[model samples]
Target chain A: MNTAMLLLTYAVVLGAVAPAMLQRASWVERAPRLAMAAWRSLTVAVPGAALLAGLTMVVPASPLGAPLARALDACVMMMQDSYATPQRVLIIMVALLLSVAIITRVAYGVGVELGRAWWERRRHMAVLRMVARRDVRLDVLVVHHRAAIAYCLPGRGGSIVLSSSALSALGDRRLAAVLAHERAHLRGRHHLLTATARGLRRAFPLITLFATAEREIDRLAELAADDAAVHASDRLTVADALLTLADDHVLPGPALGTTPHDTGQRVRRLLKRTPPLHPVVTLVIALLAWTAMAAPLVAAAMPAVATIGVDCCPTR
Target chain B: MRGFGELEAAIMDVMWAAEAALPVREVLNRLRPDREPAFTTVQTVMDILYRKGWVDRRLEGRGYRYWATAGRDDYVAGLMSSALKSSPDRAAALARFVERMNPAEVEELRAALEAARTGEPPP
Candidate 1:
């Protein structure tokens, strides 16, 4: 009964409460890095808690509260009985199979995405090698396109590509800001975060949590990159470069660049300084995030704790 | 130093520079005057290029002659355009480089570019 209740709580929190709570948590925007960690924890904790809850139900109930040895015997007997009954055996088999399927599916999704990204990056590199000229001064690949485009294809030998239109589009200062933005993406390795989020969302599109997490992570990566860019260049320059590139179409595949959706919001954030999050608030939130992750397992283990207590203590 | 990628690029360069279609042996001989690659290697590369729509081939005698269908500049532009098209999420991809702007903002950018070009103060 305790196991069942725990399972119910886990399901409710994972499927409904967590997603809704996160959606309403406006403060997440202020502390994106911490919020991202919390979201990641929830992603793992949901499945982990569900699995533990299922395992707890499999263990037989001890009414007399036997000691360690007797309890072991009861557990062994219950395990045998669980397989002896066709219905219980089928449930266990289905649960085990489902877990395996979910794990394999996510693994396959991640593998495919990474492989595709690598392949595309290789092809882009090959093409860039042929046509793009080395700009020794700027240390970026200069392509001859009239449309303004600036992006970086990330890898060991990745190059930052800029179209001729981009050179003429912005002044020297604004150009520096754009370069700083692209460098920030490469330095931060934001592509990996976006790719992982994409893989998770693709693997589990039905899960509202994965979808929400992917969107938030995508936005946060841009914000983080913008923050990095702002460090090197002034806010006005970055904001101007952003507006200049806003209308230009982006070259696709695995390349990360300065332009992102929500330019208006980013520009506004850059112009208006936001107060730093309080350290106590950040610490409290971090603790709550971890606690939320651990609570399910703790709930599932309560009966076992009681069993251990009864075994260790003797009542008059 | 001369991998399949380099070989493909070499082949494209020869075809793009040539006035007319070149045969397989001719393409190989033009690649490296010092030490030429095997005929089959060049043939295979050309076939791969043809399949990829980078080059067009026509039956002439025992083997086909290949030529670049697009100019080098057009080919590079196509590559750039295709890269943008290849993004799984167009919005996310563009967001990496720039943010989405409304018509008013785009107009502002156009005006700014014009001002920079004509020596007028930016609006």
Candidate 2:
């Protein structure tokens, strides 16, 4: 019965509650970094909850309300029972399979994504080394292309790439702003975060929580990078640079360029200048995020403890 | 070190400028007529260049004759495009800049750029 309840909790969280909560959580845009943390925690928590639900059944029900050692003995006895009903054994097998499947899927997805990113970065580095001219003053690579595009390839030896057209198009101030924006992406390692989110989404495409988290995290990464860019260059300059490069499509790969999905919205955000979230509010949100992560573990553990207590000491 | 290392670039430059495909011996001869690199060294660098898809080689008599697959400008342009194409999944990568914006937004951007240029406050 407790196992059923735990499974139900996992289903409700992954299916209904998470999608609804994330949809309504519009304020996430105000504090993207915190929101990203919360979303990532929620993504991890769903699978964690499922694993916990499966583990609960492995622990045998204790009817005597006994001590920990006695309850553990009862669990072992239940496991060793040759006469154990086929139905119960089947349930245990299914639970074990489900937990293992979820874990394997997530791990495989992350590994594939990391490997692909690594490979793409290597190829891009080689290509950049061969073609791009280093501009020491701007600390960027200038590619002699007619199209106006600017982006940064992320990694240790990664570089900011700007097309010759982009250099000619933007004024000095806007150019600086664009440089700052690309620098922010590199400094923050936004590509890795986006790639991780992509991996999780690939692992659990059917789960609304992972899908929504992936999209939100991608958007918020851009917003957070914009915030960082604003520090070095004024709002208008950054906005102008965004507009100038607005038509340029980054070469499809691991490059994290300044071309956000919603340029108008980002531009408006820059104009309004929403202040950063207060430290206390950020702290509270962080605490809530941690609590959410811990909830599934506590939920899964409580039933096992209760079962142990019931078997160890019936009278109490 | 645009794409190729110094030695690789020298090889590529020689091949690109050559009127016809050059064997390793001829490439080495043209690269440095005075000191002259070893035949094997030129062969190795040319092989690396071939593997990297910068040049194509054909069997000419006993040895391989190599030629630049693309002009230097075209190669540089291709590199620029490839750098942009770094995303693992092209379909799901971030939206292109102009595709996301409408005509009205384009006008707004123009206004913003104009305002920035004139030092006028955004209206």
- Could you list the CA RMSD of all candidates, in the order they appear? 6.5, 5.2
lDDT (Cα) of model 1: 0.69
Give the per-residue lDDT of model 2 (tens digit) for B51-83. 989889999789999998888788777665554
- Docking outcome class, model 1: incorrect
The segments of candidate 1 whose C-alpha lies over 4 angstroms from its true place after superposition are: A55-74, A81-94, A108-123, A136-139, A155-157, A249-261, A294-316, B1-11, B22-53, B56-66, B83-95, B106-123
| Residue-wise C-alpha lDDT for candidate 1, range A163-265, written one tens digit per residue | 8888889879888888887887787776666666677778878888878877777777667677667777765567778877766644333333333335666
lDDT of 2: 0.69
Task: State the DockQ of every prediction.
Answer: 0.20, 0.24
Against the correct fold, how does model 1 do in TM-score? Answer: 0.73
- What is each model's TM-score for chain A? 0.78, 0.83
Error of 1 at A26 (Å): 4.0
